[model samples]
Target: MQQNEFAIWQEFDPHAKAWQTLNNDRSRNIARKLGIGDPSTARECLDCHADAIAPEMRGDRFQISDGVGCESCHGGSELWLNSHADSSVSHNDNLKNGMYPTDQPIARARLCLSCHMGTADRMITHRIMGAGHPRLSFELDTFTWLNPHYKIGEAWTKRKGEWNGVRDWAVGQGVAAENLLEVLTNKSAGWNGIFPELVLFDCHACHQSMSDRTWGPRQGTGLGPGVVRLNDSNILMFRHVLAPIDKAAAARILEQTRGLHRATTQSRDATFAAARRLHATIDGLLPTVAAFDYGPDSLDTILSSIEADADRGEYRDYAAAEQVAMAAQSVVVAFENDGKVDSEKAAQLRSRLDTLYATIKNEDSWSRQKFRAALAALRAAAP
Candidate 1:
């Protein structure tokens, strides 16, 4: 019923009078796994693309095919699909004629990063989750090498497409987490659409540990396997990108990497514990800078509060609490910003923050409820 409901990338090759084949079925499987109802439906895929416009009217040219399209990453088969058998059309000719946006390795990385990277073309709304879809991640060569996600058989490999060999998919070269973070950190780059610093931790850093028994019910405690190892190969790559800006962070990263390899190789579990602690610390620090909204506290208040707490110079005791409070406040503000001034979004933000605050710790003296009330008033005043 949606627009472009029938716009799937049909596998049919007109010249051969048969369906074009994919060596691996991962794409089809992922579509089904996403529970999109009908894998063949074009609208479903479009829903995840630029074609799924918001209620707000925008330029008519904003097509969903601009992102996440089969042809967007793969080649547009319109010409080749129908004309490959004309004898006049060679494979190279088909490539020349097709509209494969992600033909080169770096370009392919960029194409996936368009949404996954969470830096480019993000639509902002004032909701607690921020506007638009959250960014995923990118691992250029690694991505193409993912047999479960993409098919890189001889047919695909031999083609001059975006995928480099799987071996090149290592942590070093491609758009790992670190690379995405660099693009995101640059305010001039316009990657502020997604929540900040989320890219710091790997997906498993949150998702896997979320299912762990040791994770408990702590708010913002992080959700995943709680691995102590530095899973954020992206952050390593990010450090390289940011090295030009913050020498301290760069040096610290190098030090951490050296230590991390030793820890991981020694006792994986112990290393995971250390990594979890480190991740928690960094995770707490990131939200303030990423979204830059701290609800009733404001950025100045939040930073001042943290600095004031840290000024006590007691790293072990109450100082850590102060840092956590500041981080929590920042998170609350981010949620509020995500909700914007919309009634529904406001309610969602309020609920998430209140719940997280309650579960994180029982510092009843902080008066989070009072703070929530004040933010509610501000939301009512916002235009």
Candidate 2:
């Protein structure tokens, strides 16, 4: 959140060359071409790119150039700024005074997703994407690790309490699913005239060649040929997230998700109705996922469940394949971190990891058979 998101291209390595090349210099013309160019006039552009807050709330030192500043994720500083500095004030105290509790997984996911995935109030809409905005994809742990300013060691854990990459991944998927469902069900944000928002559907589904014929059956969607399936990557990942926690619930959500896809073939009303039910299912699971402990056994379950799906031809889409690879890596590393993976197993998993990564290296060249083979190998090698 520290980088100048508007003029920025990269987040800091604590010393990344973000200031040398501004994202604004790259985006300003596009915004101008789209007719929302000026930051002074275009609040939509500033909402995600810069620290666009109310004038009354801006501190004297606050500058828009800071991009996503402390207040952007931490909340409006008016109430907690001075108090947060005092050692006597507690984290809870800061939260009580309006500081955002980013330390908590669900809360942090919600905050990061507001811009990375987008919220109704601040959407990087399909219109924006069509006009050259990059396609937004986020995995909380993956994105968080991209710009590491600190280590999560003994001192960090003491100050922040328990932290787990698997827990973060699972909670992230649930929240991401919730966010998409929220947008999908919204009257204004979810719909563009008679059609559901195109962004909610898998880009690769329609973007691929007219003669590709790569489309295949996915139990999660049940979508047939020529169908622009809704992008339920997070939803599918969320089902795996629930597997070890609540197997029955996970099974139920998967069926509901398939129903959601089927509803799309019917009518807009049917689709939204199915989406609303699935949203409630995921919403209820978030609390349990956040608080649940993820041990070696649970991590193994996650890995295997993802593999089982892929093997069954349930993850044929490029986006879903991408998510599965990430989920496997997160779960395997979490197992290794907990000292559950032996050296030989770890080495094998790493080799398989390379294979898995190689399969999805190029979205345009994504092959269901190749990805499934890589995942099967990874699952076999995983501890």
Cα displacement (angstroms), candidate 1, residue 33, comes to: 25
Candidate 2: misplaced stretches above 4 Å? 1-25, 39-41, 82-87, 343-347
Clashes of each: 30, 5
**All models: lDDT?**
0.38, 0.80
Instruction: Return the number of clashes found in candidate 2.
Output: 5
lDDT of 2 by residue, 270-293 (tens): 978998999989888789999999
The stretch of ten residues in a row with the least summed lDDT in candidate 2 is: 13-22
Candidate 2 global CA lDDT score: 0.80
Q: Kindly report which residue stretches of model 1 are placed more than 4 angstroms away from their true locations once superposed.
A: 1-68, 75-92, 101-103, 123-165, 171-173, 177-182, 188-232, 237-383
Best candidate, TM-score:
2
TM-score of each: 0.34, 0.90
- Candidate maximizing lDDT: 2
Residue-level lDDT of model 1, residues 1-383, one tens digit each, is 12221143222212121112111264355445555454334343343343344536434444443443344355546566566445555557776787554445445554555544444344221121222223343455434433332344565555543332321222122243433434433444422343333333333334433444433221112222344323344443333322223446545554554554455445535444545444443344333223222233332333333233233321111112322333434334444544434777556656654543453243323333444443344333333
